[model samples]
Every structure is written in structure tokens, then in C-alpha cells.
Target: MLTVNKTDLVRHHVPVTMADRFAFRLVGGLSTVASVLFSKRYGNRAVVLETVAAVPAMVSATLLHLRCLRRMVDDHGWIRTLMVEAENQRAHLMSFVAIARPSGWQRFLIVLAQGAFYNSYFLLHLLSPRTAYRVAGYMSEQAIQGYTRYLEDLESGVQTDIEAPAFAIDYWHLSPQAKISEMLVSMRADEAIHRDIQHAFADALVAGKLLPDLPATDLDAGSSIGLDEKRLDAS
Candidate 1:
């Protein structure tokens, strides 16, 4: 099993603050929207390049988000958290490979194609790290709510400490509250995972394995597929 340094997680998060998680979701949504708009104006090529560059960021964010989620849920039982985290991780890794499966010849022709694109936007937003972090915080809150709902659905009798969000993706015809709640929760979970990916890049930077820069594209924006056991088995 692959593991990272737990020391990076400073405090024991019996229950994390909802503020940061919700903030993260907002930023993530904004970032995705911004990326899409940029792509529309610039062309899909630029978006593709940016997506490649943002891979590390995507991975870091996803990993850290999941890590925190696992810690929170797993405090009660590893079996459950492991099940969810593994599923989520597999989805993330698969998505990474799918988006990055360009031809080797094309890759060779375009050096740092992905990195250049991802970093360009990241740099623009660099001055506002706190704001960026708040985006991540929002996402975190939503994910907790969303995942709790999933658990609630699975084990109907189980009582989660947090209230399950009233909305879900499949049920998109609901009211404003339900719809917004669903989006927030789902986006929050995604942001947490995305944050872990950014952290991974940070680790690489610390190790001198990579240089600092913004990801060119928004890697997490495209895919909506969730991780499942079948996907894990195939991988």
C-alpha cells in the first residue's frame, strides 16, 4: 500500500471546520469556470496543454482531500474509509492517465506543454494564496456532506454526525437548496482530493524533483465519473 508522511498533517482532525471546506469548494468551482472560459476564448489546444500542466496540482488536491476525509471517517473504522479512499484514488489516477494519453511524438514536440499552461493561471492567482485556500476549505465542507449522504444511503440505519446534504447528482431537478447543497458537497470532495495533488507537487518541489509553477489547465473539471470496485480491479 502506498502511504505518505502523516507528519505533514499537523493536527488531529476529529471534526474539521466547515468554513475552510466550503471555501475550497467555491474556489474550485471558480477555477473550473475560469479554466473553461479561458479555454473557450483561447481554444481547446490551450486548455489541453493547461490540463496536462495541472496534473500534479489535481493529484495533490485530490490526495490531500481524500486523506483528510479518510482520517475523519476512518477515526471510527478503517474498513469504511479505506473503501471510499481507494475508490476515489483510483478514479483520480485513471482520470490523470486518460487526459494525458497523448502520443509520445506529440509529447516530445511539446516540452512542458502541460506545465506551462497550468502554471500560467496558477501564477496569476499566486498573490491570493489565502483566497485559494478558502476555495479549498469550501470544497472540503461540501465533500463531508456529500460523502455522509452516500454513507447514509448505503447504511440507512447509520446515523452520521453531520446532516446529509438533501441533494445528489442524479436528482438534479430539485429546489435551489438541494441543488446548491449537492454541488457544494460534491465539489468540496473534489477539492480536497485536488489539494492533496497540489501537496504532492509541493513535496516534489521540496525534494528538488520539480520546479514551482502553476498548472496550465484545470484537470479536475472534465471528469464526473466516480471510483468504483470494478475500476480498481481493472487497474
Candidate 2:
């Protein structure tokens, strides 16, 4: 597995391809509704979103690693990139757990949701890696929208911007006295990068082009970052 430094950032990365389009839009619709409903209940939503955040990346990484092992090709660092993305997302979950400790019911729900998403995404990737990447890309866009609303809520006092959780400060290497909002900003950056990374891969697959080997933090084109505790890092 590969690990790398995280950063703070979001950009606009949008492309429309047939397979990627269907997958992105299908998942995007559900995420849109989730964002609308969960934008208000910050803690609960964070738990839900983060719970399933890393599933796709982890699944993809595993599959990619296996493919490389079989083919005896390093995949030009893309596997490592995927692994780093998975780890970053898991870290996001840890940060959110500190912020919003879930109840028993929520925990059960998380288990169910995670299992379902993982299996479904696994199959999707197996059948069509390109479309699977598209799903991730679009789901991320929805998450970005959700977190953008969350930031608004914090700033407007609709949701209190509590002191950032301790783990978050350490994980992101934020200032000793960083605020929750700042943590969100840092997380948002990671999500944005992942968003682009996934979409870029999908685009390459569609175009029959070589995949980029750049770090997760460095991707081409514009992509809007989603902030959490980001989630997929929330997620």
C-alpha cells in the first residue's frame, strides 16, 4: 500500500461520457437527495457519508493490486494512488467518528449500508472499471455540494462550528488551535482531488489513454473538493 501527505483544496472537473455518465448520474441522484436531507443534521450525516466513503477506493485498489500482480506490471503508480486515496478516506472516517459518535441504530445502519455499497461497487468495477470510476466521480461531486452547504450552515450559525476534534487537528497537521471549519477545508481538498482522480481515470479508460501516475493530491483538470472530516475521508 502507498501513503502520502494530504492537502487542502476543490476544483471543477466535469466530463460527460456514455458509460461514466449513466453511472455518475444514477449515483449522483441519490447523493443529491442525501445531501438535501442530511445537510442539516451534521453529525448524523457525517457518520452516514463517511461510513461508506472509502469502500469504492478500497475495492478498486484491491482489484488493481491483484490485476498488477497477475500481469506483473506496476500499473505506473496508479495502484499506489488508489491505495493512498483509500487510506485518506479511512482517515476521514476516523475524524468524523470523533465529531459524531453514533448510536446503536446508526451503527447497524452503517454496517448494512457499507456492506451493500461495497458489494455493489465491487461488482460494478468488475464489470466495468470505467463506469465505476464515474460513479465515484459523481458521488464526490454530490458530496462536495453537501459539504458546501455544511460550511454555509456553520458560517451562518445554522450549525455551530465547534472546535475541531483533536484527531482531525493531528491528522491534517493543522495549527494546534485549528477550528472545525478549517478541518472541513482540509478534508474538502482531499475529496476534490479524489473526485478528479477518479474522473480522470474514467476518462482515460474511455479514451483508451494511459492512466496518470501523479499523486492523489496532484490531478489534472478542475474538480470541486468536498469537505468533511472529507469525507469519503468523512466517507
Best of the candidates, lDDT = 2
Q: Per-residue alpha-carbon lDDT of model 2 for 85-198, expressed as tens digits? A: 777878878888888888888788889889888898999999998888888877666666666777888999987888888888888778788888888876676777678778
Candidate of highest TM-score? 2
For model 1, the local distance difference test gives 0.36
lDDT of 2: 0.71
lDDT of each: 0.36, 0.71
> What stretches of model 2 exceed 4 Å from their correct place?
1-15, 32-39, 213-235
- TM-scores, all candidates, are 0.26, 0.82
Total backbone collisions for each predicted model: 49, 19
Error of 1 at 26 (Å): 2.5
Position 34, candidate 1: lDDT: 40
